[model samples]
Target: MKFKTSLIALSIAAAITPSLVTAEESDIEVITVTSSRMDKPVSAIPNTVTIIDREQLEQQFRTTKDLSTIIGNLAPSFSPSRQKMSNTGETLRGRPPLIMIDGVPQSNPLRSGGRSGQTIDPAMIERIEIIHGANAMHGLGAQGGIINYITKKATGDNEHQVSFDVTMPNNLESDGISFGTSYSFSGESDQLDMIGSVSYRNNGVYYDANDQMIGVDTTQGESMDSQSADFFIKLGHNFDESRLELMVNHYNMENNGDYMAVTGDKENDIPTGAIKQEQPWEAANNQVTTTSLTYTHEDIAGQQLHLQFFNQNFEAVYGGGCWSDFYDPSMEGNDQVTVCGTGDNGESLYYEQSRNKSVKWGMKASMIANNIAESGINLAYGIDMFRDTTEQDMVVSGASWVPESTYENIAPFAQLDYDLIENLTLSGGVRYEYAKLKVNDYKTMYGYGDKEIQGGSPDFNETLFNIGASYQINPSIRLYTSFNQGFGMPDIGRVLRDGDSFPDENPSIDDSLALTPIVTDNIEFGADYQGEYFTAKIAFYRSSTDYGSRMVEKEDGSGSFVVKREKSVIDGLESNITAYIGDYDDVGVNIAIQNGEYDSNDDQSVDTDLDGANISPNRINLFWTHNFDNDISTRVQANFFMDKNFKDASDEVYSSFDGYTTVDASVAIPVYSGTLSVGIQNLLNEDYYTYYSQTVGKDTRYFKGMGRTATIGFTMPF
Candidate 1:
């Protein structure tokens, strides 16, 4: 499937690239990036990286109102959006990337609750940096790559801004309407600069392609029916040859949907629907607060030194008892227990709720030394130390689902960039990581037989390395090759909950029952070409692992599963091209072709292919934008997905996702004091199920993409 899609996409690129003529040569703005710990020009970085500036973010948000979807459309290797709050299967380079907010980790590595993608509000973001592929610069959870959301910074002398926006469905439907407002203030003096902003948003119910109420996903949370708010502030003071900065941010969101899901008929391609229900509890809730302090000294003893300390607190509450089914054995003889208490007789009953809470604190220190031994070599060395504590429990029953676990990690790394020759550079890095985990003994939930699970402490120490080289063929082109190692641990909570224990049994933790970490070796080769009016890049990479963790279905077909470690291999090619046509029109195309396989039988042959749930299918995205002289711009975008069969076909009634295409359009114009934006998502209104919905057999999981919904909003600034 990927081969066929690649051919077609390449053909389209060949046809479009030559038609757009180049404009006069002009100096393109150079973007500075901090993904590698050392600041460098994006063009000089020997990896696939993308930067989404504030302007682009605002424009994209007008169309999708989702951060993950915007990134998926702009980045070639990223999977298509799931159209939901949880980004469970949205992998990059066939693996999940570590998400960060202002260099502070947001991902829950120990449990992977899948809510990290939306930890921060897009309204408060200044820009986003995406580093693709594996590297050792950031220790742990970089198997695929990293995405950092850079918060807004103070600009200009003294600025104060206020904005408000409101949007509703084009058809005048009462559902799916939204309203938002924000206020920002910034000031700069000779020594100090500061920026602060606050925002609030309220979202209404969602409707699908058929203009019908969409089903509620109590487990993962739905963005369409939520209320969110955010507050951010940053202060920076510049001293002679040194700088000090402090930042604080708080975000909160909660689902307010008053409906519940009703199963649909999958054989006929019918999606689940929602029905009014007597409220039991809020669907989902999330809150996050972060604080950080950073100090940098330039030319300290002929070297640059930087230090950062950060802390974060997070809590998430999920709706109902979605995790498992519960019944009172003592009440089995009474019909009232089955009918009245369980809501089987049409009477509403309060639903059980679950919550996850975590706290994380970390510090990092690094130094950059130049001209080592007068050999035209630059070196960056850093040490990172962090600790995280996480726990999950039932809100009503006070039963522990996952016991409080504490993880501490300390890593030190060094990287060198050598100017081996004029126009040629070599880079290498190595890191030593020491991680320790501690968990106390606890009793399992009543639904899990109330077993006493003994906890254990584990420690790991490993050394990882990376090497790369880049050759500047000319001012317009460059070639590069790299090899890197990445490491990550399995979801420990998943492993512990799958133990073979009952109410009458107690098991002790041992090495045999402990989860092991996974290590991946990645290799890539790529080329970049930049012209006065056009830019293009192509990269081919291969990643292999001896023992990688994956969730697989159990043989009993009870909707329960366990995590297994197996040999796996993933290889892919990604390409992107953008052309500026006469400065008024811009066209771009992105293609991603990838495949993954694992050794399911343990024969080490890697015979079983991975599914869309694990690996993204071949995808192509194209966009064209036109700008008018009157401060107006319009953009049209299209996305296509290729059909691919699943590796595990037994559980799926429909084993493959039928390919589909979608198009969206948006226009922006300067209004009163700010901007007015109008967009029509799914312009064609093609009623199609998402890849995930098509493959999953469960009726309640089937969801169709949104319809041709028109949105118009104006932001007024004062």
Candidate 2:
């Protein structure tokens, strides 16, 4: 591959030219370990790493643009874009992880069934790295670990840029807008380089916490709107010295309000009486598309190389028609009768329509080798491939409910790394997977008879593994450990099931969607510190599973949504810190913590004890950033989310999520040259709710988490 991209551009210009001429004369590269495979430097990489720089996302963007809590200020009750029911559901250490951009593999396991919730739009991020555990060279779907997004590239400087943001709120007379523009060019001696960008966002309407108007399934009056458009392009070249690149990205989102599910009880006549649709107030719509290609090469003789390719496609269409499934006092005023009629009975209904589509493609290759003689040894290697597909159609045409399904998958991987000495490091990895599924009924193909006589065709295969170690006790300390094995498969809408004789023959119904495939075994340990004024990390974990996807009890206590492959276990701990309290170079502070449990037992029958499953065992974060002397600046952030006394493996019942603490603060100054800021979010006024059994069932009260919110902005870099 162009001689390993000229030996990784001569080993990253010989290890970054004396650390870029001593980074302002000392310290400024505390940690970074691109999930191992020899990018080594998170204290030699034994696991557990998180780096989100760019001045903490521009000081947390002042107040809120809902970066889904931006890692809960720094790990604590994370809600990576919470729209619940997977409107980009995200979690790490506490489950659901694996997200990458620059290295490809941008999760979309055929739509939310492959485990990693997908949603990208963090203003084309420039930095964000997390490794945690179980890498398996980022293949076969990482089991709760990995989130790498490093964008914004193209630098040869021939610039032109622009950015804009508008937000106003204080009792809803609303306003929210975003705009962007960019352009770049280079050719001093024809090393070639190019860049492009465009953006637009409307994003308005969100108010909850008794201020009302943030409804969807709870129907407390209504509102929620979103619109988006984004585009990007980049190209780079520099032969001989080695360097090649290409990129393209596109995004589109359109969401209107009011569309909720889980309907079942309206005095239950068997129509929609168990509905769990939260936030439903009345309108619906969704879309995404992306593309990418990258290549890197430098210092061939000493080794270093990288290549990546990517593709993404997404589509969503929800039914609209002022939908309401129930509320008929025997035609007390009849509005065309409406009597819909179906299963979870809110008086039985049909034809609410549905559409879902997803596609992903990726490829990756890397190699790094430096100073291999004198036994100082250093090496790195990697390989990966992916393909995912999903298509679901639940159109009832004239009212028949549920039909159409298809899912497919393909995966491949490889990895190896050996530092041997100098801080000590060793690693290994592997992965392989193939899958296929199909279902068609078209109402039994034409005659509208035989609709579904047990449709068939389900196939899957899998394999994955990993191993690791790291040690270093000098130059500021380091320690590491690892053990891994992960797997996942199942998502064609979880293999659509639930049908048993309505107008014809039945064979004792209950197919239970024949599910299986979800295995994990993770064990990790960590520590890395670089003191001169703090830079820390801590990790401890245990994950066990024999198969996942639960909720299946029915002997009366009610529950049906099967996928109980049995066995479940999770134990955890995570920590983070970034200090530098004095010396005025710009004071700083950051913190993080997480806890976990779900120690076995969950045979569906709900639950009665052994709680701690709804995640978030404990979390607390604190932040402070200051720099005032000419270009004034200030920031203060805090977060605390605790609880998860959760239980109900099937009817054991126990739920919890009460612990709460929120605080936010911000300030920035630098006019003319651009930059003006303000902040105040969730400063007390705490009234909460976020309990789910798949979309808000027992408690669906929300308040937009915008309690004391206030923001103002401006930016420039010419």
Q: Which candidate has the highest lDDT of all?
A: 1
Q: Pick the candidate with the highest TM-score.
A: 1
Q: Residue-wise lDDT of candidate 2 within 1-718, one digit each (tens)?
A: 0123443332222100001011121443445555565566545555666666666777776676445466546544344244322433345554555676666665655345322333455666666766654455666456666767777766666665555666544464553222223333332337667766666656555443444333343222121355666676667777886777787766655554423433433222112111223223223334566677767787767778877778777655554322332222233334433344434434433233345666777677777776567455555655566666565543333332334444455556555557676767777666676655555543332212333545555667777777778877776657778887766643334334333222346421123334445667788876655556554555567766555543333343322233344555556656554455564332222333343334245443322332332243355565667787787778776665555455453544354555566777778888887777776666554544332322233223232333344566666657
lDDT of 1 at 611: 67
Error of 2 at 303 (Å): 38
Local distance difference test values of all predictions, in order: 0.76, 0.51
TM-score of each: 0.92, 0.32
Distance (Å) between predicted and true CA of 645, model 1? 1.7
After superposition, candidate 1 runs with Cα above 4 Å error? 1-29, 322-350, 501-506, 512-514, 555-558, 648-654, 716-718
Candidate 1 lDDT over residue span 167-201, tens digit each: 66545577678777888899998878999999898
User: Model 2 Cα displacement at 356 (Å)?
Assistant: 11
Taking every candidate in turn, the Cα RMSD to the unseen true structure, in Å, is 4.4, 23.6
